[model samples]
Every structure is written in C-alpha cells, then in structure tokens.
Target: MAGTTDSGTGEYGGTGGVAPDRAGPAAAPPAGTAANPGPRRSSWRYIGPGIVVAATGVGAGDLVATLIAGSTFGYTLLWAAIIGCVVKISLAEAAGRWHLATGTTLFEGWRSLGHWTTVYFAVYVVVWGFVYGATAMSSSALPLVALFPEGPGLKTWAVITGLVGLVFVWFNRYAVFEKVMTVLIGMKFLIVMYVAIRVAPRLGDAVAGLVPVLPDGSLLYTLGLIGGVGGTITMAAYGYWVNAKGWTDSRWMKVMRLDNRVAYITTGFFVVAMLIIGAELLHSSQIALTSGDRGLIDLGTILEDRFGVVTAKLFLVGFFATSFGALIGVWHGVSLMFADFVDRFIRERFGVDTEDMVEMVASGQRERSFMFRAYLLWLTFPPIGLLFLDEPFGLVVVYGVLGAFFMPFLALTLIWLLNSGRTPAQWRNGLLSNVMLTAAGLLFVVLCAKQVKDLIW
Candidate 1:
C-alpha cells in the first residue's frame, strides 16, 4: 500500500516528485546510492512496474469471474468491478508508499510487525506459490491447446509453459521482464477492446451500471466480483516492483502514484471489456459455462458460432497473453519476495550479519541470486504433479482459506503501519485513506468468510 503527501524534501535524483532524504529523524534511507542523472526523469518512462502488476494481478480467474457475473446479471454489478479496481489502487499505493516513504522494503516492514508476520509470509509464499504454479501454467496452456488442437495436450502444455516462465524470469532482470510484460498486456488491451467494441454495449445501461445496486440473490456474486477484480498476492508485491523500478526515495512518489493509477485504470478497461462481452453475448441467451479457465474455451466456441473463427482465435490469443503474463509475473515478483523473506529470516533468527543485504537487494543483485531462482524453480516444478489430478482436495481447501484472508491481512496491516509512529507523520494515512482502508478490510473479511463457508459447506 502507498501513502504519499505533497509534504517532503525537494527532489534529489532529478525526479519530479519531492524526495525526502531522510524518512524520519529515527530512520535512514536504505543503502546503495546511484548517480543522480540530469533534470527530473519523465514519469511516462517509469510506468512499467504498474503494468507488470496490473497484468499479473488480472489473470484468467479474474476474467472468468467478471464474465460469469456479467452473464448472470448483465451490467448490474459493473460498479462492483469498478470498485474492486479502486480498492486495489488503495492497497497497491499503500504498499508502494511504505517503501518510498520509509526507504525500506515492505518485507522489512513486515519483520518489524513481528515474527508472526514473517512466519505467515513464509508459510503463505511456499504454499501459495506451489499451488499457484500449477494453476497458472494450466491456465496459460488452455488457450494454447484450444488454438492449436493438434499441439500438446493440457498437462504437457502446462509443463512446457511452466518451464518457459521459469527460464524467462530466471535469466532476465527487471528491465527485460517489464518490457516483455508491457508487450503482452498491450496485446490484451487490443484484443479485449476489439471484442468489447464488437459487442456494442448499450450506452445508457453501461452508464447506469456505475451506480451501486444489488440485484436479487446476487450478494455472494456481487461480493466476489467486487473483491476479486484483478486482485491477488500481487497487491502485496507492488512495493517490490516500486523498488525494482529504482525509485527508493519519496522523490518518486508522484511517479509511483501515476503508475499505480494507470495500472488499476488499465485493469478497469480489461474487466469492463470482458463484462461487455458477457452481457452482450451470453446474458440474453442464458448460457451456462463451467467455472475456471476452461470456461473461457466454451466462450471461444460461442464466439466462433456468432462471430467467426478469426475472432475466436484472437480471443484465445488474448487469453494466452493474460495467463502467461501472470505466470511470468509471479515467477519474478513472488520469487523476489521469497528471497527477501529468506534473507531477513536468516539474518534475524540465525544472527547472521547481512548488513549489506538491503543494498544488495535494492541494487538488483537479489533478482539474480540463487535463493531467488530457487523459489522460481519451486514455483515451476513442484506443482506440476497437481496438473495430473483434479488437484488434492485438502490442499486446495487450504489454499483457498489462505488466499481468502490475504487482502484483509494486507488492508489491516497497512492501516496499522501507516497510522503508527513507525511511519513519518506526513506519509501517514489521513481521513480518506483510513476510511478506504477500513472499508477494504471489512469488505475482504466478509468475502473471505463467505469463501470459507462456501468451501466447507
């Protein structure tokens, strides 16, 4: 979560935003200083990390959820989708703000919260990444298998996709990773926009959807759409992306905010486009599709019937881009988090002196470290076996429970950190920020409880 006020020292690294040299009287900026380049860098060029987050966070599951909502209720829950994006903007901004304002990574801040934070994260990443690996690879492979039926089948393609993501993230740095994600997300934008236009949504109905309304029996679905839009653990990873963007100080606050806004806004466009497709094509017909990424394949068949083979194929391509972007994004982002978690745990628990770990990590060395690649491998290989079965029932249940609570954990923790003395006064949450965070926290708590209830019952 990112908190920024127009209150700070003058910009130092030729950046447009004010850069506070010192976070507070008590805290110093993390080590590793780069040569300040001439006149403030353009915010336009600094937009890559948000694109990475937006692309990663809005994966196949998000699209499927939006599609299901739109098909079931037309545009009645469109406001929910929009609200989901807004809530996410708050979370991502807070995460980014914590890093820029404090000059410390979010993981380090989590450590300060206590060993429980460390333990929760450690257990979460290992379990979450393991399950997510199979899920992501299988999602990415679905559209491919659909498009090229004669090619590899689902499990084989999943393995291949996992290996491909592993290789891509293991070998590349943030610059290369950011560029690749930009290209893929741009592909998503073009395809989804083209489909939305083809559907030709009614202007009045779409506008009316901006108003909050609850259709009969849509409470659970409404909450799901509102809480699920482009959200995942990647929200927690935003600060690492900010740091990876080489904006460690508050001077980059303006750019970070712009980047964060553009991210959710772009995500909004994607979700809106999919919702339009569903309402126009499926709602009137009252068609039912399976849940999960495979449901997208059913939609493609419908597109083929109504539109043409070309349109259906194009949608499949966009689907591939969405899933694959997430696979690689997690391959990179979460692995970075895991590396930080390991480094911090070792330093604190083992009493190992790793004074330069922060500097080394900030300077991009961590991305290339063995621990980082090990987690990347963990995300790739161990979950491959899950692709064969329906997936172990017990493990899926556990994944669901943990995944449900992550957002609430993030929202409440940010509220605690931002309001506390640990954060500088100027960067702390004000009235609006507190309200938004609190609302977000409550929303997720209800949604999370619902998720657990649904699973158990």
Candidate 2:
C-alpha cells in the first residue's frame, strides 16, 4: 500500500504506531500488477480517474460560460480556456501527489496544515452542497425539459434526476461508477465535436485563435474564461478517486501524473471545440447568450439554424450528460471529501496514525457513515426546494464570493505542505511545482479580489 514508509528509508526508527507502510485505507495493488485488469487495453484505463475528474468538474455553468464567451468575445478568449486547463492539471496533480506521498486522505493533510482548513472546508462543503445541488439538478433537467415534448418544468425534472443520482451512487462499486461516467463523457464529447466540426470557422481565424488576444469590452468575459477552464470542487475529489483506483501508494505516482495530464488535455480540447462552435456560428449573428445554462440553449438555436434539428438535439444531449456527470460526481466524490473531513478530525483525531484513522472511519467504527450519505443527499436533493424558490441576489452573490475562496485555499495549502519537511525528501516539490502552484495562489487571490469587487459596493 502507498502510505507505507519507503522500504529503502529507515526514517521511522521503528518507534511507530503500526509502522507506516502503504498509505491509505485501500491498499495499493502490487507494483507490477496493472490496476485495471482487462483485455489488452493500450494504457488508456489509467485514464479513468482523470476522465471522471474532468467530467465532474466541467458543468452547465462552465459550458454556458464558454458559450457566452464565444458569443461575446468569439475566439479571443480561447487561450484562457486552455490556461484554465493547465491550472487544473497542476492542482489535480498536487492533490494526487499528496495522497501518494503522505499515504493520507487530503483531509488528513489539511488537519496538519491547521484547524482553520478543516473548519473552512466543513463550512464550505455544506454551503456549497446546498447551492450546488439545486443548480446541478436544474441544469441537468433543463435539457430533458427541452427534449421531451410534454416534459415537465425544469424543477419537476430536476427533482427526479436528483433522486436518480442519489440511488445510482448509493449502490455502485468503484469500477461500475467509472464505466457509467465514461459512457456519458463519450456522448457529451461527440455532441460538442459534431457542432464544432460541422460549423468550424475559417482556417485563418482558427489559426489566429491559437494566438492569445483579449477582445474589446470583454474584461469580465476574459476573467471568467480563465476561471472556468475546467475545474470544480471535484478537483479536491482527485484524492478520493486516487484512493478508489487502488493507486493510493507512491509507486503509482508516475501513472497518476500521466493520467492527470492526459485528462485535462482532453478537457482543453473539449472547451476549445465549444469555443469554435460559438465563434463560427454565433459571433457575427448578434444573438446574445444570457447568463445560466440558457446560453447553451442559444447555441442549440444557432446549431439548429446551421445544421438542422439533429445537431441541435445532439448538443442538448451533451448538455445533459455534462451537467449530470457533474451532478453524480459531486454526489459521490465530494461526499467522500466531506465524509473524510468530518470523519478524520471529528471522529478519529486522537493523534491517530493515518492507517488506523482511516480504517476506523471506513469500517463503520466511526459515526459518520451516515454523514457521507447525509452530505450526498444534501447534494442530490433538499436544495430542490430552492429550484422553485428563487434564491435572492444576496445569496447568489454570497455563493459566488464563497466559491472564490477555494482556489487560493487549495493553491496555498499545497505549496506549503509540499515544501514542508513532512513530505518525503524525494516527493518534495521541485522548482516547477513550487513555481506553478505559487503562481496559481497569487492569481487566485487576485481573482478573489475581483469577485469581491464585483459583489460589493
């Protein structure tokens, strides 16, 4: 298993409480064994956790954000989407690194950082769960509302979809969950690719988009594009997926890095294709994309006008798949993060070692097996009430501002933790990791300031 001490290092002096060996609850697979045993799949199964992470992170707001950018700034902000992918890749790799290096859940790492982290996360997860629940379900259900001729209102369908997610995540094992997510991700990718290919812009403009340039009157649009590349609370979920994939030990580090890199490369391509569809089909048409998932609705109209109903419907399927992928993702993944948070500090914090700590928590020796499902249900439903009841401007503003706090929290914590001596000498971050995460921290603080300014007087 990963969290265990390196066989080469005699660092523990063997005074240890259950001597550190393979790190977390799920033991790492033997070093030479391929984790996903199947037909001779050429190294792609390693892509599982990363693809799930990507699908979970990108959502209706993200897609809508892209559509609005394409409508307002055309290909001008394509660079930002790609930049966002780079940022997420860094963060995801760090989260995965912490797991492999420390043999602990991310919550364990956060507790080491300070109680403030645990407390901040606890509060953030709850509030974020409530707000995100309604938004995700409603967004997923919107496409259903459109596609079904006599479909119910989005709220009605939202409630039903939320129920479905709750039940789906309730019973499935890790591999089953990953496979279902893969299928949904594939469908969404096809729809986005179809729109982009059918309506590709002039070759000159497409090449020009490869160059970085900000459009006029689009500062806010540019900021959003940079922020919305493809990441979410699920970036934190990377650790859980790492744990679930039997990649918990440090030996899996190389494959984990490759997986994170390839996954976000796929994400960059996905967002860029959406941008091309917008730039080619809607940029000059003077059709504005209003805020929210409705922006994708605007794209569907442009798609329908340009390529007929089939293509438009394909895009709608893409919207549902992307939105609901995020929905189930939060339902399963974030709940693990939240459960780990509550279970780590609240239940087993008797200066417990990571292995015993996690074993106690996972084996129902702790009180919050129910807490995980509580948060999951919180994420999957309850907030459906808010779907019918409009959230006030103050609430939405608060949600936005609260969200601005997480990126900096993640960036700063990773930089400090990895630099600290607690990290094994070999696993300590190199100059590139330090530079990238530090830059991410500073950029996030600036983004936070901008979000605050936008929200305040």
Runs with alpha carbons beyond 4 Å of true place in candidate 1: 1-4, 9-42, 353-359
Alpha carbon lDDT at 336, candidate 2: 76
TM-score of 1: 0.93
Who wins the TM-score comparison? 1
Backbone clashes, candidate 1: 10
Clash statistics: count for each candidate: 10, 11
lDDT of 1 at 70: 85
Candidate 2: lDDT of 273?
Answer: 85
**Tens-place lDDT digits, model 2, residues 188-221:** 8888887788885676776677788876777666
